[model samples]
Target: MPTSYVKRILDAQIYDLVVRTPIDEAPQLSLRLGNRVLLKREDLQPIFSFKLRGAYNKMLSLGKAELAKGVIAASAGNHAQGLAMAAQKIGAKATIVMPTTTPQIKVNAVKALGAKVILQGDSYDEASDYAQRLVIEKEMTYIHPFDDPEVIAGQGTIAMEILQQVPERLDAVFIAVGGGGLCAGMAAYIKTVRPEIKVIAVEAEDSACLDAAMKAGRRVRLKNVGIFADGTAVAQIGKETFRILKDTVDEVITVSVDEICASIKDTFDDTRSICEPAGALGLAGLKKYVGRTGAKEQTLLAVECGANINFDRLRYISERTEIGEKREAILAVTIPEEPGSFKAFCASLNKRNITEFNYRMGGASQAHIFVGVQVVSDDDRYNLVADLGDKGYPVVDMTDNEIAKLHIRHMVGGRAKEATDEMIFTFEFPERPGALMKFLTRLGDRWNISMFHYRNHGSADGKVLAGLQIPRKDRKKAHVFLDDLEYSWAEETENPAYQFFLS
Candidate 1:
């Protein structure tokens, strides 16, 4: 089975539309990480993603009649563009059923490539179901984004190119996994050809289907999938992809959204090219690997897979990069509400550059301060907190608090005295037209909204933090309503950020 992939990879005739992507060195990252960091620049593909390789290969494998019958697929973004381009090149019709939550740039790209774009459902699974119906009705050939042998072999070409390009000894090849096609294809080829090399599969923490499947020894669907890295936001791993990957991959590394953001910044610093969150996923895992294992001077490569990010999302990504790199510490410190207390707290900081500072008088005796300070490392952050504690100031480290970073930081105001029995909740919903209205409508007039904050991060999902006035007697009812809402919601009533700044 493994040797079959080697032949399929060799026979993959993708050079017609795919290029031999370059493997460039990341000088600054290499120096900082103390490892020879190399980037497989698959972002430079004709469609700005390696998805084209698999798409074109699968199309080319079809008979003349099949090609003439047209092809259909469900994709978040990259695969749609790849399939559209492939169909255009081969003079066949293509229909791409994409989630309504997909970025406008991707939708426009598919249309520009002469593909019929149909906006469906809020997630890939929903769109995929819609695509299957269309496939039957239109009698078109369904081109799966992953799972097919031709598609897997096509992605394996990247592994083939890596072996040929990097003649030097390599420690590992890091690949990002969605449905597992990319990792399975690459891992099968690499393991069979070079057994000594490690094939590392990187996944976003919110959407690690392959990791879940491997642990269970069977594929299991995730209850909820995060779309921050929309390209890799798959709920379940493909049967074919999981079979190949379970045997070939050496390790699986899952990364946070902030870590992915930091890698995007890392890629931009070295190559002067912006990578989407999923594109930079492999590099994020590579950095974590080096930091944890203390691997040094060894050659490691990460696939920089795509650059199809929305320009507006850069600000949100940039804001979180500092925290991801462990260079910023966000804390909630309590001090006496007296004349000299503020000055004393500042002096205790030892003139460190303060990134953010928020103060509000909570009572006659105490004041809560929400602050962000520049830190060199995680140790430095702890030392700063310890020093503040020694100076008679109570501190709560909020650097890793999702609610604090996303919403509480922006809404750091003293609590409203009238807002009694307030329950805080964070919800994630598809960022489509009338989405907010629909969410509010679901709640109806049952609970009064005391505090609310929403910010669009230019991704598929919209994050909202809301405080509602719900009495203890109606708590069970409120939870029942939330559970039936079908949105990813978390009760943040006990969040320290809310208690320190708002309550």
Candidate 2:
């Protein structure tokens, strides 16, 4: 059944342009997880991504007439560069339509390859629509990033290489899924050749089209997808890829942005190479799988698929790595507003490293302090919280609180007494030109914005924590207005972090 793909993968004429990436053993990760972990270093490809293999292979299939007509595609970044280079090598003009929010690095890389770059829309789906229209208007062939059979076959070559490189038995192979091409290709080949080897498909929790599809027993579209892992932030699985993945994939694992950050750190520790969020996704799932299954001494492989991340994003990724690895705990603790209360709280911490401390005077009786503590394990974090509570310091763990980690930790302060009837909401929207102003414009002047906090994480999405003074009588109407804004948001008025720090 899968021999067709195997044949195509073997015959893919990509070696001239695509490098055979090496597989490296991750000694640190293996020792830490108690499992033999291997990394397929696709990040070392000439384009610093595995995308070139597929793009070049697909271009090679084109006849001279089609090549003369030129080619077009929509990509967030990596695939655009790959296709641009492939088209240039084949002497075909290439046009790339990329999302406006795509990192400037990728935009420049594609332009450097002599491709016509058009920035349109804020998401991949929207840019794809524009690319399709251009393809029709310009009479150019559209090279799909992950949906085509040629593309899938090209990606399958990675699996074939992995099998050939690893002489030892592998219990499982973790593959990252965007529109499911890589997973579908690898899983089909793996199952066909070595049916006993498990194929685990990893996806970002916020962009888990495959997980959603698997649950529904059909492909499903997501209303919104987080773009931290922009390479994999696809809203839906591709039709052909899904057809193969539905049956071939043995399991699906969804990881959080923080977990992905932690995996990037882990990859760096072992490989000394930085990985983009999507590149580290498979490793994140492998870590999660090891944690859940506790299958010690087992051999596993994960694909590091890309390294096209913007340098500026490292700050945000570094900030979240500690928490992602369960090495840091953020908490809100209430102690007496007395002079020695600080010392007493410190004593209760059992000398654990304090990563952060944010404090502001509250009322005369109690003081709310935002503190970050280094921890060894989840149990250690729980014990620290218990110890604080036992010492009569009322504590609320903000470690898993999204608002706390994203916004509150940086802007913690006393309550806003004058900002009455304030409704706080956390929002995420595309990070593009005038996006913030556009959001504010849509919010309108009906209610005063009492509090606002925003930080750029160098991803395609921008996050905002806004507080608006909406009277109780008009809250339902205010909600209606927010819904009409069409941005992904959630009410944070009841969040404990907000209650302790900003309410």
Candidate 3:
């Protein structure tokens, strides 16, 4: 009677092609929120995304003559790979035009799948323009990534799978929306099959086209889309997908980039699977909603749609993960400029260890020290702040401050110079009992410490700064032994201050 029934049939026909991706119960998430949580692992698809399900289905539905003409599509990454792989399997010629800035890994993958890869402009819109021109010039059938009914129908299969996998009727399902294809398809089918179930579409706050369109009661184009989550960075929603999503989707919510990063880390900790920022959008939305609405009893499902992360980007993800989760705090502490003053500040740290400490001369009386501390929980951060307050120390919490996180951490240590052969090394060490003593014992009397500084600034671990004076003749040998020190040390010998002061 409804389009959901048709969706179910289509899903059945493509069941062999589509992976029966796991709908694992997220016990950690469930216990933390006191709610039942299910994670739909569409990220495990053969193409590393659920886009393959829709792309393949769309190509398979094409008429014989249409297939002969071949297909052209535009995408930044995931969809391009999906369409290319789908077209290859169906023996249809496919041309995938992607932005020039698209990751090389994705470009090579599409080419490996026997698709003609075209590098176009800097963004998806420019690539799409080039793709449309090719479609007209080559007389190829242009496959709309999200707007077409057939494509939407294919994406709708995910909803059918979700219903089949989860035993209980979900109170709400969070779908990450980009051009509205996934959300439109899932919402159209889910609302038809289970009218009482809420369909929430999640989008990055920086690029929330559906949210803007819904507010205006029509399609709205965003001036700029955030590139943090490349998979879901759409400036505009498709015409057909918008039509379906407008009525079917219960709510469209936006989340910050930090929230998405936090969820990605959470997913890794829970499942050991690294989801890209876009893939973690559904989980971010679920967490936001649960925190805001306090819907602890609601049965919630989060669709993890893809896991195509660039290997290099993991460093940035890892760096921001703790701050995103509020587990790490960066603080700027002002302490009196005196020899014993450093020890007094360390004593004030109480039980907290110093993760990082950098001291720079602010004035004659006080030193501006940047410190990093690890907190057991979010509430522990408040406790640390209160402790600092009681100690009469001026502390500025830069935990969520973006500029401080990036520029301040490395520049906190004071300016100093050592001899030409001396090397300034920075080390991060655990702040346990006898750790500092062990470090001092290891250095011994062989290396003259030109500049030695250490501060325990309320972090879980401590950071040490040392300038080792090595003879010009022994520089190479000293470097070799330092490498074997087996500590997190970086050579700052090339730094300008080392040239001017140490040299």
Q: Report lDDT per candidate.
A: 0.93, 0.92, 0.78
Q: List TM-scores for all candidates, in order.
A: 0.98, 0.98, 0.78
Model 2 per-residue lDDT tens digits across residues 156-175: 99998988888579999999
Clashes of each: 0, 0, 5
Any runs in candidate 2 off by more than 4 Å, and if so which? none
Q: Which candidate achieves the best lDDT against the true structure? A: 1
Q: How would you order the candidates by lDDT, starting with the best? A: 1, 2, 3
CA displacement after TM-score superposition, residue 29 of candidate 2 (Å): 1.0
RMSD of 3: 12.5
lDDT of 3 by residue, 1-503 (tens): 23743544355355656787888788888898888888899989987888887787788778999999989999978888889888878789998998765666677878998999988876688899999998889899988888777677777888887887775768999999989888888887788878899999999998899999999999989986666777887899999888888888888889986788889987887788988888999999998899889897779999999888777667667777777776787777778888898888888887577777776564688777777788866678878977997898977777765445543455455454433346677766544457688778876788788766675432223467677878888888877786776555677666433332223
Q: Estimate the TM-score for candidate 1.
A: 0.98
Q: Write the per-residue lDDT of candidate 1 for residues 1-503, one digit (tens) a residue.
A: 67889999999988978999999999999999999999999999978999999999999999999988889999999999999999999999999999999989899999999999999999999999999999889899999999999999999999999999987799999999999889989999999999899999999999999999989999999998999999999999999999899999999999999999999999999999999999999999999999889999999999999988899899899999999999999999988889998788888889988899888677889888889999988999999999888878899999999999999889887589999999999998999889989988887878899999998888789899999999999999999999999888999999999988897
